[model samples]
Target: MIVFLAALLMILGLIGRMVYLMVFDAEYYQKKAEDLHERERKIKAARGEIVDTNGTVLATNRTVCTISVIHSQIKEPEVVIKKLSKCLGMEEAEVRKRVEKVSSMERIKTNVDKETGDKIREMELAGVKVDEDFKRYYPYNELASKVIGFTGGDNQGIIGLEVRYEDYLKGSNGRILTTTDARGIELEGVAEDRVEPVAGKTLQISMDYNIQMYAQQMAEKVMEEKQADKVAILLMNPQNGEILAMVNVPEFDLNEPFTLNQDQEISEKSKEALNQMWRNGCINDTYEPGSTFKIITASACLEERVVSLSDTFSCPGYRIVEDRKIRCHKVGGHGAETFVQGIQNSCNPVFIDIGLRLGTGRFCDYFEQFGLLGKTGVDLPGEAATIMHKEENIGQVELATMSFGQSFQVTPIQMAATVSALINGGKRVTPHFGVRILDKDKETVRELKYDDGKHIVSEETSRTMQALLESVVSEGSGKNAKIEGYHIGGKTATSQTLPRSANKYISSFIGFAPAGNPQILGMCVIYNPQGVYYGGTIAAPVIRDIFDNIFPYLGIEKDVEMQYTN
Candidate 1:
């Protein structure tokens, strides 16, 4: 009777303890139970796409699967390895190593196609799973390869616009709260609590698909014909600073960005080739503007009112400054000519005289005003340029060479943007590619913007410069650049390269069309071109061809009917 009574009292005390626990620790115990059964897994957000102004997709996504294995749940490791190796085209050992990893999930491969993923899923091999993911694709292949750079393995933009607009392209990742049993088996009939990932914003760029193709085609043809190391071409609107097309050749396939396009055995040479392949010279690299820079000096002279149309200067083929004699293109000299005629003749000595007149202080001021002293505020990566001479220390020789566009380095885009200013009523406009950002629903999130630009010269000066440039195409060094029916004004430049003995050169051309009210501005730079190295002979024709193709597409009517002869 005493033992029964003690048992009953003990039972009552345990019940009292349970009641106290339910009342005091209920919330904490419930949370612990929930945590034991639930697991959270990441859901990768879909990367945004890139499209041209016409809504033709340039960069898009491919639906792919990420194949992974849970080591704890994989019962027959050998079977899983054998099947995965065959389906994924990987080594059996590689599959085995991945399956044996000490982790919740080991990714065997990513970017597996749906058909291949379906084949793996049909096997239903224990612990093997296929999850949804995305792979970036450039449908246009090599078109605008540098401008629309390819992404990395993790879908991050590594170059060009891909890197420039990363924040908008990379969206927030979501998660799935899965309910699983103690043995790592997902519970039956229990719906997964999901937080859906938001898709990234889209990048609407200024590149037109047809225009990009035209520019690239011209670049490729010239790159092969010229047998040049590389070629870069850029076309932009002088008014708004929108880049219509930018091409760098030879272009590599964006799909296989790491693979070398050239036929080369794997070595240090191959490594260098790869680095050179990915480089975007239009923005990241710098080259001496050569004769293309002459326009800057002329524009500066005109803007500063140091030279007039009627002002006459004599060129004895060369000018003497501080023991140095800078020679003109014409060895015999263009002696006794008006300032306008000097520009038409592209007389180096005449420019040297003009440069000496401006002095270093005044010339550098015009240079800074023209956007050469700093970056153009372009929305790209790795912009570069060099101001060889400082204003404070400028001497006779330095000013002389600079006057004729020598001894300094600037990128092609910088020269293009500055040229636009010279023609576009002297407005110092900033060059740019992006147009606007759009949400998943195609709603306008915001406008991709740039500065409104400042006036660097009077309208009258701009008009006068346009006429002089037009004369260059009509009767000067740039005559070959003329599109018979349209008035195309441009300057030709041939610059000497390093190690003066090597005789390498960069041949370039900068031009605009419809001389009266110029619309499109362009510049082409050809590096180490074989055989002929004159800009008028080599680079000007390339721009002329590009203009021939793009002129009609842009609906810019030929002001005068000077039918082009094929």
Candidate 2:
């Protein structure tokens, strides 16, 4: 009886200790469970707005409804899945699979709109919940789609202006982490959170919507008329380097990008097409500048004092340099011509002689000075620098060819900006599309100006180049670009396709409007036309067309007093 009592006493003592731990240490176990159920929820801040120069909204985001599912609360998984599949237009099998995979019972459909949210909620379906999210919307549709770009499903900019200005467009994401109950409901207690999100800033572009639309229409019309492989158009303020309009033919709609692409396997051809579509061709593509480059050669020669304006060269069809014959565009020859006449006729042999005078050392010096050896560093993506060949092979013949824009490749924007500098008093300005960046309160944080200038050449050289260019339209090869009331100056280019493969050509026209006191500088390019690929034939007329509508529409003074200071 004494031994039995001792064993009973020991058992009672052990039971008492067990009871103490269960009640006194309960809070410790509860805290660990809470930690396991805690979650950090991301509160996404809204994306910034993209507006035109005139303050028209190009892209914006708005709050919309979303549907979610919680497996633990679901009374009938199969029935709920079936109803959700029908209402959300999702496959029943897919919904069932998603519901089954919910480790803690939270899945979201990501669809927006009150009608859809209401339809799902009307079912009184267990486990279903409604939430709000911001969705991107583009108002312009296909207009300036490539320029404005688009956002992806994750609300991130993937290309064009979207990707270029992502830092300013994507706002910071705020987050919160809190413990939840067994039912996945937040407990009324302190929570862990992060800093509040900073809303994205607004971007006010330099684009003129009306001009953009017209330019796009003109590109489309030309693409159809010329049956061109590709067409690119750019309009800008020559005096300021501000881009007023930019358009590329075969434009893809940002809201519907899938139509242009089918399978995602990227090939060389597909890559080229994608680049052609996604990139702004004015700054992205490089081509032999053709005769348009003649002006640069003339400028180099004039600036280096190697050739006088009245100097003359006789051409009996071609010039022989190191046993290589350089032929003129006229084939048989331009015969005899002065420096001005040489530029007027775009005489290849005359430019060759001028290039020889400038010499390899001097020519390369001016080439780099003109900003042709590197990228323009414009505020766009994929800006290709001029393709300068090996300087070792830059002999008299090569220099001659380069003088006329044949030996080196250049982008259209490079040509435009350089030409603009040539005419705008030697002020080498950086070209830009975005005019300024504004905050939510419409406060300007950044604004672009043209006075950030570097003098490329003397004022005399600029004036001389301007006069020479004007003469081309008035009495030379670019007569087709002449407007009755406007003093228009332009350069025509017919660059030969590489490999001399079957004689293909890429024609281009670049010029500025109201030649005196210029306003708009424009460039148009047509790649591989079936027939008549001369820049004057295919490209100049396009410039004329653009200027014709643009002048009157822009309300620019056409009958302004002609200042004959030059």
Instruction: List TM-score per model, in order.
Output: 0.90, 0.88
lDDT of 2 by residue, 167-275 (tens): 9889887766666676665566656556566778889988888889888998899888888888888888877788888887778877765434443566787667665
Per-model C-alpha RMSD: 5.9, 5.8
Task: Report clashes for each candidate as comma-separated counts.
Answer: 1, 0
Could you say which candidate leads in TM-score?
Answer: 1
Q: Model 1's lDDT to the true fold?
A: 0.86
What Cα-based lDDT does every candidate model obtain?
A: 0.86, 0.80
- Which segments of model 1 are wrong by more than 4 Å? 1-38, 181-183, 260-273, 561-566
TM-score of 2: 0.88
lDDT of 1 by residue, 14-94 (tens): 999898779888898888888777877777889998889988999988988989987867889999989899999998988
